[model samples]
Target: MTETGESGGRKYDPAATHNFPDERLNAILPDLLSDPEITTYLEAQNVNAVTRKGYNDHGTKHVEIVRNRALNLYDLLKGGDVGFNGAIDQDLDEADEPVIIALAATLHDIGHVVHRDEHVYYSIPLAADLLDRLLPEFGFYDASEAVRMKAEVLHAILCHHTEEDPLTTEAGVIRVADALDMERGRSRIPYEKGGRGINTLSSQAIESVSLRPGDGSPVLVEIEMVNAAGVYQVDNLLKAKLDGSGLENHIRIVAVNTKAEDRLVERIEL
Candidate 1:
Protein backbone atom coordinates (compact mmCIF):
# COMPACT_ATOMS: atom_id res chain seq x y z
CA MET A 1 0.00 0.00 0.00
CA THR A 2 3.05 2.24 -0.25
CA GLU A 3 3.21 4.67 -3.20
CA THR A 4 6.01 7.17 -3.73
CA GLY A 5 6.78 10.27 -5.82
CA GLU A 6 9.15 13.23 -5.87
CA SER A 7 8.38 16.93 -5.81
CA GLY A 8 10.86 19.78 -5.31
CA GLY A 9 13.61 17.12 -4.96
CA ARG A 10 11.85 15.59 -1.95
CA LYS A 11 10.12 12.22 -1.55
CA TYR A 12 6.41 11.96 -0.70
CA ASP A 13 3.95 9.14 -0.10
CA PRO A 14 1.22 9.35 -2.70
CA ALA A 15 -0.89 6.73 -0.96
CA ALA A 16 -0.74 8.40 2.41
CA THR A 17 -4.17 8.95 4.01
CA HIS A 18 -3.42 12.40 5.33
CA ASN A 19 -3.98 15.85 3.86
CA PHE A 20 -1.59 17.09 1.17
CA PRO A 21 0.89 19.70 2.36
CA ASP A 22 0.60 23.26 1.06
CA GLU A 23 1.62 26.40 2.92
CA ARG A 24 -0.78 28.65 1.04
CA LEU A 25 -3.62 26.25 1.74
CA ASN A 26 -3.04 26.59 5.48
CA ALA A 27 -3.17 30.38 5.27
CA ILE A 28 -6.29 30.69 3.12
CA LEU A 29 -8.54 27.74 3.98
CA PRO A 30 -7.36 26.48 7.31
CA ASP A 31 -10.73 25.15 8.47
CA LEU A 32 -11.85 23.27 5.36
CA LEU A 33 -10.02 19.98 5.87
CA SER A 34 -11.54 19.49 9.31
CA ASP A 35 -14.92 21.11 8.73
CA PRO A 36 -17.64 19.25 10.61
CA GLU A 37 -20.30 19.70 7.93
CA ILE A 38 -17.98 18.33 5.25
CA THR A 39 -17.01 15.35 7.37
CA THR A 40 -20.65 14.55 8.15
CA TYR A 41 -21.66 14.83 4.50
CA LEU A 42 -18.85 12.51 3.42
CA GLU A 43 -19.80 9.93 6.03
CA ALA A 44 -23.43 9.99 4.94
CA GLN A 45 -22.45 9.65 1.29
CA ASN A 46 -20.47 6.52 2.07
CA VAL A 47 -23.36 5.01 4.01
CA ASN A 48 -25.74 5.66 1.16
CA ALA A 49 -23.44 4.01 -1.37
CA VAL A 50 -22.62 0.96 0.68
CA THR A 51 -26.04 0.33 2.25
CA ARG A 52 -28.27 1.14 -0.71
CA LYS A 53 -26.32 1.38 -3.96
CA GLY A 54 -23.68 -1.31 -3.52
CA TYR A 55 -20.98 0.99 -4.81
CA ASN A 56 -17.30 1.34 -3.96
CA ASP A 57 -15.65 3.91 -1.73
CA HIS A 58 -16.74 7.40 -2.80
CA GLY A 59 -16.41 8.98 0.59
CA THR A 60 -13.75 11.05 2.30
CA LYS A 61 -10.90 8.95 0.98
CA HIS A 62 -11.96 9.46 -2.64
CA VAL A 63 -12.49 13.18 -2.12
CA GLU A 64 -9.13 13.58 -0.39
CA ILE A 65 -7.40 11.80 -3.25
CA VAL A 66 -9.12 14.09 -5.72
CA ARG A 67 -8.24 17.15 -3.66
CA ASN A 68 -4.56 16.26 -3.54
CA ARG A 69 -4.36 15.33 -7.21
CA ALA A 70 -6.32 18.39 -8.35
CA LEU A 71 -4.07 20.73 -6.40
CA ASN A 72 -1.02 18.96 -7.81
CA LEU A 73 -2.29 19.50 -11.36
CA TYR A 74 -3.24 23.10 -10.68
CA ASP A 75 0.15 23.98 -9.25
CA LEU A 76 2.05 22.21 -12.01
CA LEU A 77 0.05 23.92 -14.76
CA LYS A 78 0.17 27.31 -13.07
CA GLY A 79 3.93 26.99 -12.59
CA GLY A 80 4.22 26.19 -16.30
CA ASP A 81 2.37 29.40 -17.23
CA VAL A 82 -1.00 27.84 -17.99
CA GLY A 83 -3.77 30.36 -17.44
CA PHE A 84 -6.78 29.53 -15.29
CA ASN A 85 -10.20 30.55 -16.55
CA GLY A 86 -11.05 32.66 -13.52
CA ALA A 87 -7.54 33.97 -12.86
CA ILE A 88 -6.77 34.91 -16.47
CA ASP A 89 -10.08 36.76 -16.70
CA GLN A 90 -9.68 38.52 -13.33
CA ASP A 91 -12.59 36.60 -11.84
CA LEU A 92 -10.53 34.80 -9.17
CA ASP A 93 -7.23 35.63 -7.56
CA GLU A 94 -4.23 33.42 -8.32
CA ALA A 95 -3.88 32.64 -4.62
CA ASP A 96 -7.53 31.60 -4.43
CA GLU A 97 -7.20 29.04 -7.25
CA PRO A 98 -6.08 26.22 -4.98
CA VAL A 99 -8.84 26.89 -2.48
CA ILE A 100 -11.49 26.76 -5.15
CA ILE A 101 -9.94 23.64 -6.71
CA ALA A 102 -9.72 21.89 -3.35
CA LEU A 103 -13.27 22.81 -2.40
CA ALA A 104 -14.65 21.65 -5.73
CA ALA A 105 -12.63 18.44 -5.63
CA THR A 106 -13.58 17.60 -2.06
CA LEU A 107 -17.31 18.24 -2.39
CA HIS A 108 -17.99 17.02 -5.94
CA ASP A 109 -19.48 13.67 -4.94
CA ILE A 110 -21.73 14.78 -2.10
CA GLY A 111 -24.71 14.73 -4.42
CA HIS A 112 -24.72 10.94 -4.23
CA VAL A 113 -26.91 11.56 -1.21
CA VAL A 114 -29.71 12.35 -3.65
CA HIS A 115 -28.97 9.89 -6.45
CA ARG A 116 -26.05 8.63 -8.49
CA ASP A 117 -27.13 9.58 -12.01
CA GLU A 118 -26.80 13.30 -12.79
CA HIS A 119 -25.23 13.76 -9.39
CA VAL A 120 -23.06 16.50 -10.84
CA TYR A 121 -26.01 18.82 -11.32
CA TYR A 122 -27.44 17.92 -7.95
CA SER A 123 -24.10 18.69 -6.32
CA ILE A 124 -24.14 22.34 -7.39
CA PRO A 125 -26.77 23.51 -4.91
CA LEU A 126 -25.59 21.22 -2.12
CA ALA A 127 -22.03 22.50 -2.46
CA ALA A 128 -23.19 26.09 -2.92
CA ASP A 129 -25.00 26.16 0.44
CA LEU A 130 -22.02 24.57 2.17
CA LEU A 131 -19.65 27.06 0.52
CA ASP A 132 -21.86 29.98 1.49
CA ARG A 133 -21.61 29.02 5.14
CA LEU A 134 -17.98 27.89 5.07
CA LEU A 135 -16.40 30.65 2.95
CA PRO A 136 -17.05 33.44 5.42
CA GLU A 137 -15.44 31.44 8.19
CA PHE A 138 -12.22 31.60 6.20
CA GLY A 139 -12.32 35.42 5.83
CA PHE A 140 -14.34 35.59 2.63
CA TYR A 141 -16.74 37.94 4.40
CA ASP A 142 -17.16 40.28 1.46
CA ALA A 143 -20.56 39.47 -0.04
CA SER A 144 -19.65 39.75 -3.69
CA GLU A 145 -16.42 37.80 -3.30
CA ALA A 146 -18.17 34.97 -1.51
CA VAL A 147 -20.86 34.83 -4.17
CA ARG A 148 -18.28 34.68 -6.95
CA MET A 149 -16.26 31.98 -5.22
CA LYS A 150 -19.37 29.90 -4.64
CA ALA A 151 -20.27 30.16 -8.33
CA GLU A 152 -16.82 29.03 -9.40
CA VAL A 153 -16.77 26.13 -6.96
CA LEU A 154 -20.18 24.97 -8.12
CA HIS A 155 -19.06 25.15 -11.74
CA ALA A 156 -16.06 22.95 -10.97
CA ILE A 157 -18.30 20.42 -9.18
CA LEU A 158 -20.73 20.28 -12.08
CA CYS A 159 -18.00 19.76 -14.62
CA HIS A 160 -16.29 16.84 -12.84
CA HIS A 161 -18.48 14.43 -14.82
CA THR A 162 -17.52 13.69 -18.41
CA GLU A 163 -20.90 14.72 -19.85
CA GLU A 164 -20.11 18.29 -18.88
CA ASP A 165 -17.21 20.31 -20.27
CA PRO A 166 -14.90 22.00 -17.75
CA LEU A 167 -14.48 25.59 -18.88
CA THR A 168 -11.97 26.59 -16.21
CA THR A 169 -8.53 25.30 -15.39
CA GLU A 170 -9.59 24.40 -11.85
CA ALA A 171 -12.65 22.56 -13.10
CA GLY A 172 -10.58 20.62 -15.63
CA VAL A 173 -8.12 19.65 -12.93
CA ILE A 174 -10.96 18.43 -10.71
CA ARG A 175 -12.35 16.33 -13.58
CA VAL A 176 -9.11 14.47 -14.18
CA ALA A 177 -8.41 14.18 -10.48
CA ASP A 178 -11.73 12.45 -9.86
CA ALA A 179 -10.88 9.88 -12.51
CA LEU A 180 -7.45 9.12 -11.04
CA ASP A 181 -8.95 7.45 -7.93
CA MET A 182 -8.78 4.04 -9.55
CA GLU A 183 -6.35 2.22 -7.28
CA ARG A 184 -7.45 -1.30 -6.35
CA GLY A 185 -8.15 -0.41 -2.72
CA ARG A 186 -10.92 1.89 -3.90
CA SER A 187 -12.88 -1.06 -5.27
CA ARG A 188 -11.69 -3.85 -3.00
CA ILE A 189 -14.81 -3.80 -0.86
CA PRO A 190 -17.30 -4.26 -3.69
CA TYR A 191 -15.01 -6.47 -5.80
CA GLU A 192 -14.52 -8.98 -3.02
CA LYS A 193 -18.27 -9.10 -2.53
CA GLY A 194 -18.72 -10.30 -6.14
CA GLY A 195 -18.83 -6.99 -7.93
CA ARG A 196 -18.61 -7.80 -11.62
CA GLY A 197 -18.06 -5.98 -14.93
CA ILE A 198 -15.43 -3.72 -16.38
CA ASN A 199 -15.67 -1.04 -13.73
CA THR A 200 -14.80 -3.35 -10.86
CA LEU A 201 -12.27 -5.41 -12.76
CA SER A 202 -10.49 -2.38 -14.18
CA SER A 203 -10.25 -0.83 -10.75
CA GLN A 204 -8.92 -4.07 -9.29
CA ALA A 205 -6.17 -4.19 -11.89
CA ILE A 206 -4.86 -0.72 -11.02
CA GLU A 207 -2.01 -1.07 -8.54
CA SER A 208 -1.14 2.57 -8.13
CA VAL A 209 -1.30 6.05 -9.72
CA SER A 210 1.29 8.75 -9.15
CA LEU A 211 1.32 12.42 -10.06
CA ARG A 212 4.55 14.34 -10.52
CA PRO A 213 6.30 16.97 -12.64
CA GLY A 214 6.93 15.93 -16.21
CA ASP A 215 9.90 16.50 -18.49
CA GLY A 216 7.96 17.45 -21.66
CA SER A 217 4.65 18.30 -20.06
CA PRO A 218 3.72 20.20 -16.96
CA VAL A 219 2.35 17.10 -15.15
CA LEU A 220 2.86 13.39 -15.55
CA VAL A 221 0.17 10.85 -14.57
CA GLU A 222 2.02 7.57 -14.16
CA ILE A 223 -0.21 4.53 -13.58
CA GLU A 224 1.08 1.10 -12.58
CA MET A 225 -1.13 -1.90 -13.17
CA VAL A 226 -0.95 -5.52 -12.09
CA ASN A 227 -2.46 -6.59 -15.42
CA ALA A 228 -2.59 -5.08 -18.89
CA ALA A 229 -6.40 -5.15 -18.66
CA GLY A 230 -6.07 -2.19 -16.32
CA VAL A 231 -5.56 -0.06 -19.43
CA TYR A 232 -9.36 -0.04 -19.71
CA GLN A 233 -9.48 2.15 -16.61
CA VAL A 234 -7.02 4.59 -18.16
CA ASP A 235 -8.29 4.47 -21.76
CA ASN A 236 -12.01 4.40 -21.10
CA LEU A 237 -12.42 6.19 -17.78
CA LEU A 238 -9.43 8.48 -17.26
CA LYS A 239 -9.07 9.38 -20.93
CA ALA A 240 -12.73 10.35 -21.20
CA LYS A 241 -12.35 12.60 -18.17
CA LEU A 242 -9.25 14.31 -19.60
CA ASP A 243 -10.28 14.58 -23.25
CA GLY A 244 -12.50 17.66 -23.00
CA SER A 245 -10.70 19.06 -19.99
CA GLY A 246 -8.82 22.29 -20.70
CA LEU A 247 -5.68 20.93 -18.98
CA GLU A 248 -5.03 18.18 -21.53
CA ASN A 249 -2.17 19.99 -23.23
CA HIS A 250 -0.41 20.32 -19.90
CA ILE A 251 -0.64 16.60 -19.02
CA ARG A 252 0.88 13.34 -20.21
CA ILE A 253 -0.58 9.98 -19.06
CA VAL A 254 1.34 6.71 -19.18
CA ALA A 255 0.22 3.29 -17.96
CA VAL A 256 2.54 0.32 -17.51
CA ASN A 257 2.29 -3.26 -16.28
CA THR A 258 4.21 -3.86 -13.07
CA LYS A 259 3.76 -7.61 -13.41
CA ALA A 260 5.23 -7.51 -16.90
CA GLU A 261 8.61 -5.95 -16.12
CA ASP A 262 7.23 -2.41 -16.38
CA ARG A 263 6.26 -2.81 -20.02
CA LEU A 264 4.55 0.16 -21.55
CA VAL A 265 0.84 -0.41 -22.02
CA GLU A 266 -0.60 2.89 -23.16
CA ARG A 267 0.57 6.47 -23.57
CA ILE A 268 -1.60 9.49 -24.29
CA GLU A 269 -0.91 13.18 -24.71
CA LEU A 270 -2.78 16.03 -26.26
Candidate 2:
Protein backbone atom coordinates (compact mmCIF):
# COMPACT_ATOMS: atom_id res chain seq x y z
CA MET A 1 0.00 0.00 0.00
CA THR A 2 2.83 2.38 -0.64
CA GLU A 3 2.37 4.93 -3.42
CA THR A 4 5.48 6.12 -5.29
CA GLY A 5 4.36 7.92 -8.42
CA GLU A 6 2.40 11.09 -9.13
CA SER A 7 -0.61 9.03 -10.23
CA GLY A 8 -0.70 7.49 -6.73
CA GLY A 9 -0.34 3.98 -8.07
CA ARG A 10 1.08 1.31 -5.77
CA LYS A 11 4.80 1.06 -5.30
CA TYR A 12 5.08 -2.54 -4.28
CA ASP A 13 8.39 -4.26 -3.80
CA PRO A 14 7.67 -7.85 -4.83
CA ALA A 15 9.90 -9.03 -2.05
CA ALA A 16 7.76 -6.95 0.26
CA THR A 17 4.81 -9.29 -0.29
CA HIS A 18 6.03 -12.08 -2.53
CA ASN A 19 9.10 -13.83 -3.87
CA PHE A 20 8.92 -12.12 -7.29
CA PRO A 21 9.41 -8.37 -7.60
CA ASP A 22 6.65 -5.91 -8.42
CA GLU A 23 8.64 -4.63 -11.38
CA ARG A 24 8.37 -8.05 -12.97
CA LEU A 25 4.57 -8.14 -12.81
CA ASN A 26 3.92 -4.46 -13.49
CA ALA A 27 6.12 -4.85 -16.52
CA ILE A 28 3.63 -7.26 -18.07
CA LEU A 29 0.03 -6.21 -17.22
CA PRO A 30 -0.29 -3.55 -19.90
CA ASP A 31 1.14 -5.90 -22.50
CA LEU A 32 -1.50 -8.39 -21.51
CA LEU A 33 -4.09 -5.64 -21.84
CA SER A 34 -2.73 -3.96 -25.00
CA ASP A 35 -2.84 -6.53 -27.75
CA PRO A 36 -5.32 -5.55 -30.49
CA GLU A 37 -6.50 -9.14 -30.73
CA ILE A 38 -7.13 -9.20 -26.99
CA THR A 39 -8.89 -5.89 -27.16
CA THR A 40 -11.14 -7.39 -29.79
CA TYR A 41 -11.67 -10.41 -27.61
CA LEU A 42 -12.70 -8.27 -24.65
CA GLU A 43 -14.99 -6.17 -26.82
CA ALA A 44 -16.82 -9.22 -28.08
CA GLN A 45 -17.67 -10.54 -24.66
CA ASN A 46 -18.33 -7.11 -23.18
CA VAL A 47 -21.69 -7.32 -24.90
CA ASN A 48 -22.69 -10.76 -23.74
CA ALA A 49 -25.77 -10.70 -21.53
CA VAL A 50 -24.31 -13.29 -19.16
CA THR A 51 -21.24 -11.11 -18.58
CA ARG A 52 -23.24 -8.04 -17.58
CA LYS A 53 -24.53 -9.42 -14.32
CA GLY A 54 -24.32 -7.41 -11.03
CA TYR A 55 -21.27 -5.43 -12.08
CA ASN A 56 -19.29 -8.50 -11.07
CA ASP A 57 -18.34 -9.85 -14.53
CA HIS A 58 -17.42 -6.66 -16.35
CA GLY A 59 -14.07 -4.96 -16.92
CA THR A 60 -12.87 -4.27 -13.40
CA LYS A 61 -14.98 -7.06 -12.04
CA HIS A 62 -12.96 -9.58 -13.97
CA VAL A 63 -9.70 -8.64 -12.28
CA GLU A 64 -11.43 -8.00 -8.99
CA ILE A 65 -12.77 -11.52 -8.88
CA VAL A 66 -9.39 -12.85 -9.84
CA ARG A 67 -7.56 -10.94 -7.15
CA ASN A 68 -9.99 -11.93 -4.45
CA ARG A 69 -10.14 -15.52 -5.57
CA ALA A 70 -6.38 -15.87 -5.82
CA LEU A 71 -5.78 -14.35 -2.43
CA ASN A 72 -8.48 -16.53 -0.95
CA LEU A 73 -6.84 -19.60 -2.37
CA TYR A 74 -3.54 -18.59 -0.89
CA ASP A 75 -5.14 -18.07 2.47
CA LEU A 76 -6.83 -21.44 2.20
CA LEU A 77 -3.50 -23.04 1.47
CA LYS A 78 -1.92 -21.53 4.53
CA GLY A 79 -4.87 -22.31 6.78
CA GLY A 80 -5.24 -25.84 5.48
CA ASP A 81 -1.62 -26.48 6.46
CA VAL A 82 -0.59 -27.17 2.88
CA GLY A 83 1.03 -23.83 2.06
CA PHE A 84 4.37 -25.17 3.17
CA ASN A 85 4.13 -28.22 0.97
CA GLY A 86 5.78 -28.69 -2.42
CA ALA A 87 8.61 -26.20 -3.05
CA ILE A 88 7.48 -23.92 -0.30
CA ASP A 89 10.14 -23.47 2.35
CA GLN A 90 9.53 -23.02 6.04
CA ASP A 91 11.04 -19.55 6.14
CA LEU A 92 9.66 -18.21 2.87
CA ASP A 93 6.26 -16.49 2.64
CA GLU A 94 3.82 -17.82 0.06
CA ALA A 95 2.12 -14.44 -0.30
CA ASP A 96 4.94 -13.36 -2.59
CA GLU A 97 3.45 -15.49 -5.31
CA PRO A 98 0.18 -13.53 -5.32
CA VAL A 99 1.21 -11.25 -8.14
CA ILE A 100 1.52 -14.14 -10.54
CA ILE A 101 -1.75 -15.63 -9.34
CA ALA A 102 -3.56 -12.31 -9.51
CA LEU A 103 -2.26 -11.53 -12.97
CA ALA A 104 -3.18 -14.96 -14.26
CA ALA A 105 -6.66 -14.69 -12.76
CA THR A 106 -7.03 -11.32 -14.42
CA LEU A 107 -6.06 -12.62 -17.83
CA HIS A 108 -7.36 -16.20 -17.87
CA ASP A 109 -10.79 -15.27 -19.14
CA ILE A 110 -9.53 -12.83 -21.74
CA GLY A 111 -10.08 -15.67 -24.13
CA HIS A 112 -13.72 -15.71 -23.17
CA VAL A 113 -13.97 -12.63 -25.27
CA VAL A 114 -13.55 -14.98 -28.21
CA HIS A 115 -15.57 -17.93 -26.88
CA ARG A 116 -16.40 -19.68 -23.63
CA ASP A 117 -15.66 -23.20 -24.78
CA GLU A 118 -12.11 -23.69 -23.47
CA HIS A 119 -11.09 -20.06 -23.31
CA VAL A 120 -7.70 -21.41 -22.22
CA TYR A 121 -6.67 -21.73 -25.89
CA TYR A 122 -7.32 -18.05 -26.48
CA SER A 123 -5.62 -17.23 -23.18
CA ILE A 124 -2.25 -18.60 -24.34
CA PRO A 125 -1.76 -16.39 -27.39
CA LEU A 126 -3.28 -13.37 -25.74
CA ALA A 127 -0.88 -13.82 -22.81
CA ALA A 128 2.06 -13.92 -25.19
CA ASP A 129 0.97 -10.63 -26.72
CA LEU A 130 0.55 -9.08 -23.30
CA LEU A 131 4.08 -10.07 -22.28
CA ASP A 132 5.46 -8.54 -25.48
CA ARG A 133 3.84 -5.26 -24.50
CA LEU A 134 4.80 -5.48 -20.83
CA LEU A 135 8.59 -5.72 -21.11
CA PRO A 136 9.35 -2.09 -21.84
CA GLU A 137 7.05 -0.74 -19.15
CA PHE A 138 8.75 -2.57 -16.27
CA GLY A 139 12.27 -1.35 -17.06
CA PHE A 140 13.22 -4.83 -18.18
CA TYR A 141 14.93 -2.96 -21.06
CA ASP A 142 16.38 -6.39 -21.84
CA ALA A 143 15.02 -9.61 -23.29
CA SER A 144 15.62 -11.91 -20.35
CA GLU A 145 12.75 -10.76 -18.15
CA ALA A 146 10.53 -10.50 -21.19
CA VAL A 147 11.08 -14.15 -21.94
CA ARG A 148 10.53 -15.03 -18.33
CA MET A 149 7.24 -13.15 -18.19
CA LYS A 150 5.98 -14.86 -21.30
CA ALA A 151 6.74 -18.27 -19.88
CA GLU A 152 5.11 -17.44 -16.56
CA VAL A 153 1.89 -16.06 -18.01
CA LEU A 154 1.54 -18.84 -20.55
CA HIS A 155 1.92 -21.42 -17.82
CA ALA A 156 -0.73 -19.67 -15.74
CA ILE A 157 -3.31 -19.40 -18.55
CA LEU A 158 -2.98 -22.96 -19.80
CA CYS A 159 -3.27 -24.52 -16.38
CA HIS A 160 -6.17 -22.44 -15.07
CA HIS A 161 -8.77 -24.91 -16.37
CA THR A 162 -7.09 -28.16 -15.39
CA GLU A 163 -4.44 -28.98 -12.78
CA GLU A 164 -2.76 -31.58 -15.01
CA ASP A 165 -1.11 -28.83 -17.04
CA PRO A 166 2.47 -28.19 -16.00
CA LEU A 167 2.72 -25.00 -13.97
CA THR A 168 4.83 -22.85 -11.71
CA THR A 169 3.73 -22.24 -8.14
CA GLU A 170 1.69 -19.17 -9.03
CA ALA A 171 0.05 -20.85 -12.00
CA GLY A 172 -1.04 -23.72 -9.81
CA VAL A 173 -2.79 -21.39 -7.34
CA ILE A 174 -4.58 -19.46 -10.08
CA ARG A 175 -5.72 -22.71 -11.67
CA VAL A 176 -7.45 -23.72 -8.47
CA ALA A 177 -9.25 -20.42 -8.17
CA ASP A 178 -10.34 -20.51 -11.81
CA ALA A 179 -11.79 -23.97 -11.36
CA LEU A 180 -13.53 -22.90 -8.17
CA ASP A 181 -15.31 -20.13 -10.06
CA MET A 182 -17.99 -22.70 -10.83
CA GLU A 183 -20.31 -20.05 -12.22
CA ARG A 184 -21.01 -19.40 -8.54
CA GLY A 185 -21.32 -15.64 -8.68
CA ARG A 186 -22.85 -15.39 -12.14
CA SER A 187 -26.42 -14.62 -13.15
CA ARG A 188 -28.59 -17.41 -14.50
CA ILE A 189 -31.24 -15.67 -16.60
CA PRO A 190 -29.30 -15.08 -19.79
CA TYR A 191 -27.49 -18.39 -19.55
CA GLU A 192 -30.63 -20.31 -18.72
CA LYS A 193 -32.57 -18.72 -21.57
CA GLY A 194 -29.97 -19.16 -24.29
CA GLY A 195 -28.43 -22.52 -23.36
CA ARG A 196 -29.45 -25.27 -25.77
CA GLY A 197 -29.80 -28.03 -23.22
CA ILE A 198 -30.38 -28.63 -19.52
CA ASN A 199 -26.70 -29.24 -18.70
CA THR A 200 -25.47 -25.95 -20.13
CA LEU A 201 -28.09 -23.90 -18.34
CA SER A 202 -27.76 -25.70 -15.03
CA SER A 203 -24.05 -25.21 -15.22
CA GLN A 204 -24.74 -21.49 -15.37
CA ALA A 205 -26.67 -21.11 -12.10
CA ILE A 206 -23.97 -21.02 -9.45
CA GLU A 207 -24.96 -19.18 -6.29
CA SER A 208 -22.44 -19.79 -3.52
CA VAL A 209 -18.78 -20.72 -3.70
CA SER A 210 -16.06 -21.65 -1.20
CA LEU A 211 -12.67 -23.35 -0.98
CA ARG A 212 -11.62 -26.11 1.36
CA PRO A 213 -8.01 -26.67 2.18
CA GLY A 214 -6.54 -30.16 1.82
CA ASP A 215 -3.77 -31.64 3.94
CA GLY A 216 -0.80 -31.70 1.59
CA SER A 217 -3.15 -32.60 -1.19
CA PRO A 218 -5.37 -31.00 -3.86
CA VAL A 219 -7.71 -28.31 -2.52
CA LEU A 220 -11.40 -29.11 -2.22
CA VAL A 221 -13.75 -26.68 -3.95
CA GLU A 222 -17.33 -26.35 -2.78
CA ILE A 223 -19.99 -24.81 -4.98
CA GLU A 224 -23.61 -24.40 -4.01
CA MET A 225 -26.14 -23.74 -6.73
CA VAL A 226 -29.62 -22.32 -6.68
CA ASN A 227 -30.51 -24.87 -9.34
CA ALA A 228 -33.33 -22.64 -10.59
CA ALA A 229 -33.62 -24.31 -14.00
CA GLY A 230 -32.30 -27.84 -13.78
CA VAL A 231 -29.79 -29.33 -11.32
CA TYR A 232 -28.64 -32.37 -13.21
CA GLN A 233 -27.74 -30.40 -16.30
CA VAL A 234 -25.21 -28.24 -14.44
CA ASP A 235 -23.93 -31.12 -12.34
CA ASN A 236 -23.01 -33.36 -15.24
CA LEU A 237 -20.99 -30.74 -17.11
CA LEU A 238 -19.09 -29.44 -14.08
CA LYS A 239 -18.55 -32.82 -12.45
CA ALA A 240 -16.66 -34.33 -15.35
CA LYS A 241 -14.19 -31.48 -15.47
CA LEU A 242 -13.80 -31.27 -11.70
CA ASP A 243 -13.27 -35.00 -11.53
CA GLY A 244 -10.74 -34.80 -14.29
CA SER A 245 -8.82 -32.13 -12.41
CA GLY A 246 -6.10 -33.78 -10.30
CA LEU A 247 -8.14 -32.46 -7.39
CA GLU A 248 -10.79 -35.17 -7.63
CA ASN A 249 -9.36 -36.81 -4.54
CA HIS A 250 -9.38 -33.57 -2.62
CA ILE A 251 -12.16 -31.62 -4.30
CA ARG A 252 -15.58 -32.20 -2.77
CA ILE A 253 -18.67 -30.34 -3.96
CA VAL A 254 -21.55 -30.23 -1.55
CA ALA A 255 -24.91 -29.17 -3.04
CA VAL A 256 -27.45 -28.12 -0.46
CA ASN A 257 -31.14 -28.77 -0.86
CA THR A 258 -33.16 -25.84 -2.02
CA LYS A 259 -36.81 -25.32 -2.91
CA ALA A 260 -36.21 -25.24 -6.69
CA GLU A 261 -35.37 -28.95 -6.86
CA ASP A 262 -37.31 -29.67 -10.03
CA ARG A 263 -34.88 -31.80 -12.07
CA LEU A 264 -32.93 -35.07 -11.91
CA VAL A 265 -31.64 -34.15 -8.50
CA GLU A 266 -29.08 -35.98 -6.43
CA ARG A 267 -29.77 -35.98 -2.74
CA ILE A 268 -26.27 -35.28 -1.42
CA GLU A 269 -23.64 -33.83 -3.74
CA LEU A 270 -23.64 -32.00 -7.06
In order, the Cα lDDT scores of the candidates are 0.76, 0.51
Candidate 1 accuracy as lDDT: 0.76
Ten-residue stretch with the least lDDT total in model 1: 4-13
What value of lDDT does candidate 2 attain over all alpha carbons?
Answer: 0.51
* Model 1: residues with Cα > 4 Å off, grouped in runs: 1-24, 88-90, 261-270
Q: Give candidate 2's error at residue 56 in angstroms.
A: 13
Instruction: Give me the displacement of residue 253 in model 1, in angstroms.
Output: 0.6
1-270 per-residue lDDT for model 1 (tens digits):
133332111122334333323454556544887788899988888776766777888887787777767776766776677777764354656667777887898799999888876777778889988988988878744787788888888888989998889888888989988898888878877778888878888888887777777888888888878876687898899999999998778899888777855455544333
TM-score of each: 0.87, 0.61
Best by lDDT: 1
Expressed as tens digits, the lDDT of each residue in 84-133 for candidate 2 is 22223212223325545655666777766665666678768876776677
Q: Which lDDT value does model 2 have at 187?
A: 32
